[model samples]
Target: MTSRVLTCLLLSVLCALPALGARPVPAPAADGMAMLQRVDTARVQGSPSTLRTELDAQQAKAPKDPMPRVYRAFLALPSDESFAEFKALAVVYPENPWPHVGMGLVYVRWGMLKDAAAPLETARKAVPGFAPALWADGLRLQAEGKPAEAEARLREALTKLDIPRFRTDLALLLAGRPGAAAEARALLVRSVKDWPEQPEALQVLSRLAREAGDAKAGAEAGALLVALQPHDREAHRRQADAWLAAGDKAQAVKMLERYATLGGAEPAVLSTWVKLAVELDRPEDEAKALVRLAAATPKDPEPLLRLATLAEAKQDVAATEARLDQAAALAPERADIQVRRARLLLKLERYFESMAAYRAALAAPERPVPEAAEEAAQLTRKLHLPASPAKGTVEQIYDRVSLGLVALYLEHLMEKPELKGNLKVRVDLDPTGKATNVVVLYDSLQDVLITHSAHVAFMDAQYPPGSEPQVYQYVFRPPPR
Candidate 1:
C-alpha cells in the first residue's frame, strides 16, 4: 500500500474508533466514552481550541477511565509524552484494550512496526475480537510488507465492526491487489455513502474510476472532492481533467476558470483552458483566459498576441490595436509583432505607416523578414503620389512635388555623396494620379541611383482622376555646397 493509505489509517486510529460491542464496561467508563464522543464531535467541527478544552475537562472528570485517557493520549500523538501517557494507562488498566491500542497506534504512526506488534497483540489478547486493536495491527502488518496477514486482520476487524474506517482501510488494501478493484471500489462507494466527508475514500474512488475508464464516475468523484475542498487548486484541476475526459468541455472550462480565479498560476492549466475555449468557439472565454495567462507570465508575449488575434476576429479594432501594442511593448524586437502591425496598418489604409512597419520588421536584429522588403516595395507602388491633386493649384502641386524630390535627394545624398549633379525629368501622369512614364530629358549626374529614385518617386505620387492623362516637367537641381 502507498504511504498515503498508511497515513490515513494511522490518522484514523488517532482520531476515533468504533464502539467495543463485544465487551461491557462500568458506568463511569461508559460516561467517559460518552464524553469522548462529544470530544470527537468537537474535533470534527474543526475547532482545535474547543476540542482541546473539552478533552481536558473530560480527562479531569474521569482520570481513572481509560476512554478519556486514550483520547488524551491520542491528542498528544507522535510524541514521547503521548507514548508515556499510553504506557501509564496500560499499567493502570491492564485489562482495558484502548490503552494498548493507543500505544500500538503510536508505534505504527512512528514507523516502528516491530515495536507496534507487541502492544497490538496485547490489546487483542486483553479483549478478543476488538476491532480497533485489529485495525491497528492490520496497518502495522501492511507497513511490515505482510499483505496477506494484513488483509486477514483488516477483514476480521470489518467482521467485528463494519464501520466507515474499516471499510476504507480494507478498500485501500485491496485496491493494490490485482483483480480486486471491483470489490475495493464497492467498499469505498459504501464507505463514502456512510460518511460523505471522507476525503480519502473519495480520492481512492476517483482514482479507481479513472483507471477503469469510467469518465462519468470519475467526474462525479472529482466534483465531490472539489466541493469538499473548494480552495484546493489541484482538486479543481483534477475535476477539469475528469470533465474533459467525460466529453463535457463546458464543465471542464468552468472548473479551470475557477482554478485560475483562485490564483492558480500553472501555465499548463491556463493554456489548456485557452485552447478549449477556442475549440468551443468562445471568444469571451478565450480572452479572459488569455488575460489571466498574460498576467501569470509577465514575460510571455504569446498570450497578448493571441488576445490581439481574438479581438481582431471580433472586429474590435481598438482592442486589437491595444493588445498588439502591449505585446509589441513586451517584445519590441519580435519580427512577428511588427509584421502583424504592418498588416493592421495596411488594412486601415495607412500606407506610409504600413510601409514603416514593414521596414521595421525587415530590420529586426534577429530573424529579419526578407519578405517584408517585397511587401514594402509593393505598397509604395500602390500608393497615390499626391493624395488630392485636383484640390491644389498647378503651382502648389508643382511645389509639393519639388519639395518631395528634394527630400529624396537629400536622403540619398547621405549615402552617396558623389551624386551631386542635377537632372531634368519629364513625367506623364494618368488623370487617376498614376505615373505612366518617366524620361530623364537631361542627366548631368548620369547616375543609375538618381534616375531610379526620380522614376519611383513620380510613379508613387498620387494625382486627381481626369478624363485624359496629364503631362508635367521639372528641372531638378542639386543644392550648392
Candidate 2:
C-alpha cells in the first residue's frame, strides 16, 4: 500500500545507491536499532558521508527501516535533499512528527519562506509546543519585515520551550527594539549561568558586555568562551572583538591572527579587521591581513579594495592602483569600489576617468546613506559634474539629538514622554550622513541634559530628501525666559 511517491523515492534511492559503489547489507533485525542510533550519533557529530555509507551497508540487511534515510536527511544541512528524505520517511512512518519538523527546518535553512510556512505551520499544529518550528517561523516573520509580529511568535515559542539556545536567538532579535536590549543581556546572562559551557552564549555575553563598556565583564565572558570552545571560529572572533572594544589592540591582533588562521572566517570579518588595522595605523599588519584574506575568500573585489586602501595608506600609489585594478575587474557593479576608484583617479589627476567612475557609482542601485549621498553630491558639484541622488528618505520628528540627558532630556528621546526645552545637538552633517556627538555636552538651561543614546539615534540618523548639511542644537530653557 505504499504511495506512488514513496515507491518512486525508494526506487530513486535504489538506483543511486548502486552508483555509490557499496554492496548493500541486508536490513538488520529489530535488534539492529542500535546501528540506526549509531548512524544518528555520527550525523550529529558532523559526519554525514559516513552515515550515508553506514546506511548503504545497513539497507541490504534492513531495507524496511526508514531511520537511516532520516539520519541522512539530518546530515545534509542546508540542502533540499533533507526534505526529500523527510518526505519519503513521512510516508513510510506516517505517525512520526519529527520528519515533518525536519522538513520545515530544511525550508528555513534554504530561505524558502513561503514553502517553509505551510510545513512549519502544520508541524506547529500537530505538536502545539514545538520550539524548533516556532523559532523558524519567528525568524521567517522577522525577515519578512514583521518584527512586532515576529516578537509575538518568538514569545509564543518561549512559552512552548525553555531552551537556552532558542531563547538567545529570541533575545537578540528583541535587542533591536528601543529598550529591549536589556532583555538580550538578561537572556545571555541566564544562559551562561545555566549552561556555563555553552560557547555561543558566552561569546554573545562578551559582545554585549563590551558594547555596554563593561571591560571586566567582557574579559570574564570571553575567557570562559575561549575555555569552553577553544577552537571555535566565532569564539575567536568575539574574543578579538572584545579585546578591540576593551582598547587592547595588541591582544585583539593576536586573537584576530588566530581567527584568520581558522578555516571559514567570512569575508566581512576580514574586511572589519582590515578597517581596524588601517585605523590603528599598522600598514604592515594591514597589508599582511589583506593578503591573507584575499587568499582566503573567493576573488571578491572587496578584499582587493581593502588591499588598495592599505597600499594607499602606505603612500604606494602604483601598488594601490594595481590592487584597484584587481578589485575593478571583479566588482564591476559595486558602487563603493567604483567610488574608491574614482577618488584614486582624482588623486592621479585623471579627472575624466575619475568622473566616469564616480558617475558609474552614482548610477548604481545600492542605497547610500544620507551623509554619503551628501558627500557625493558635494564632490560632484565641486567638480562641476552632474550628480544623481539616492531614491529614498526617512523622516524623523525629534526636536534635536543631544548628550548627557537626564529625565528632562528623556523627552527628546525616541517615543519618550516630556521634554522641557529646545535641545541643541552637536551634529556633523557631512556627505557620509549626520553623526551626533555622543560625548558629554553640557546644557545650562535644564537641570540635566538628554541621554547620549539620543545622540546615537541622531548619529545613526538619515535625513529626508535633501542634501542639506544637518545642523542640530538643543537649547534647554526654563518654563519662562
Candidate 3:
C-alpha cells in the first residue's frame, strides 16, 4: 500500500469515536463521571491499555450503567471481546440507541462491515435521527468501496452531527476523489476552525493543503499537529514530510529534529536531516543529528568525520583534532579520513605531520586524492624554506600578505576587547608590490584608525611582483584564547 493510504488507515482507526447522539448523555452518578474522566484522560495520554482495567472496574461497579459498557466496546481492543460485549449490550438495552451505535462502530473498526449493518440499522430505527448510526453506516460503505454512498451517509450524519470527526472523515473520503479538492479543503478549514484541538483533523488538513501547493496553510496545520502530537515520533516525521513538501525547509528541519529527539532515528530520516541542516547553514542542528547518527551506527565513521568539519568551521582546533582522531581510529584505511587529517594538520602549520598524513592518503589502496601529490610537494618546499616564488606570481602570495593583515588586526581591532567587527579591503597590487587601489568594500567597525591601518598594512607590502588586485576579507573577534 502507498504511504498515504497507510497513514489514512491509521488515522481512521483513531477517528472511531462513535457519534452517540445529538445531546450529551448525562452520567447517572459521580463514579460514572470519574470513569468517563479517566477514559478521556487515558485517550489523551495515548494509553488505551489503562482504559480496559478501569472500564472493567467501572462496569463491575455500575452494572446498570450502559455508558461504561459503551466505552468498553470501544476501548476493549480485542476484536472478539469487543464484539461480544457490544452484542450483549445491544440485546440487554434493546431500547437504547447507544449500545447499537457502539456495536456498529466496533464492527466497522474491525472491518466486519457486513456484520455492522444490522446493529447500525437497529440503532437508527431505535433513535430515528441519531447521527452516530448514519456515521457508522458511512464507515461500512467506505470500507466496502462505495465512496459515493459513503459520502451521502456521512453528509446526512453531518446534518445532525456537525462534529469535527464527521467533517474530517467526510473530507478524507472526498479528498480521495478527483476534482473534489476544493470541497474537501473547505470542509477541513471549517473543521479545524471549529475544533482547533483535533490533531487528526489538522493532520488531514495539512496534507490537503500540501497537495494543493498552499504552503502557508500546510505549515499552519503542520505546526498545530506537531504541538498536538508531541509524543508521537511517526507523527512528527510525517509532519516533517508535509512541511518539506510545502517548501518550509526550516520548519521541516524543526519537525525532523523533534522526530530524532523523540527516538525516530531511522537512517533515512537522519540522513535527510543532515542534508537539510547543511543546506540551511544550521551547524548546531547538523551537529545534533550527527551525534545521534553516530550513536545509531557506532562502527560508521561518517558522522564523526562530518562533525570534524563542523568543529573546524568553529576554529576549535582541539575539538576538530579529537573528532578526526576518533574517525581515523574507526576507519584507519579509509583514504578520505587520511586526506581530512592532512588538511587539518596543514591548517595548524604542522608541516611534517601533515606530510606524513598526505603520504598515507596517497598510498591507500583506494585511489589517492587528485591534489594529494601537489599538496605534498608544496609542503616539502615549505619545510625546506625554498626561495620564494618569483614576484608578481600568485604562489602563496595571499598567505604571505595575510600575516601582515592579521598583525594589523591584532593591534588596531583586537586591542579593544569591547570592540568586535569585520573589514574587507580590495587591494590592487601593481608591479613592484605597490597597492594602486585600496577600496574598503565593507567595514562594520566604522573606525578610521583601523581602516587606515589595514590600508597601510597592505600598501607597499611586497606581493608577487605583478599580482592582480586580490580581495581579502577579515573579521576580528576578541583575541583567541
Q: Estimate each model's TM-score.
A: 0.64, 0.41, 0.59
Candidate 1 whole-model C-alpha lDDT, 0 to 1 = 0.74
lDDT of 1 by residue, 82-144 (tens): 776677666656678777887898899899888998998998898777778888899999999
- State the number of backbone clashes in model 2: 29
The TM-score between candidate 1 and the true structure equals: 0.64
User: lDDT, candidate 1, residue 346?
Assistant: 79
Candidate 3 residue-wise lDDT at 242: 77
Deviation of model 2 at 12, angstroms:
7.5
lDDT of each model, Cα atoms only? 0.74, 0.62, 0.73
Off by over 4 Å in 2: 1-68, 192-204, 220-241, 244-481
**lDDT score of model 2?**
0.62
Task: Give the lowest summed-lDDT range of ten residues in model 3.
Answer: 383-392
The model with the greater TM-score, 1 or 3, is 1
The candidate with the higher lDDT, 2 or 3, is 3
lDDT of 2 by residue, 1-481 (tens): 2365466567545543333333433222222223433544454345657768876776667665555555566667455456666766555454444566567667677777787687777756655656656767888888778898888887887776665656767777866677776788888887667556555566667777777879868977897777666567776887877777777776677677778877636777777777777778887878778887887775666667777876887799999988887886776666777777777876775544565666667776663323445545554444332122212342232432222233334444434334345545454555555443434344434432233334434544565533454445556532432
Best-fitting candidate, scored by lDDT: 1
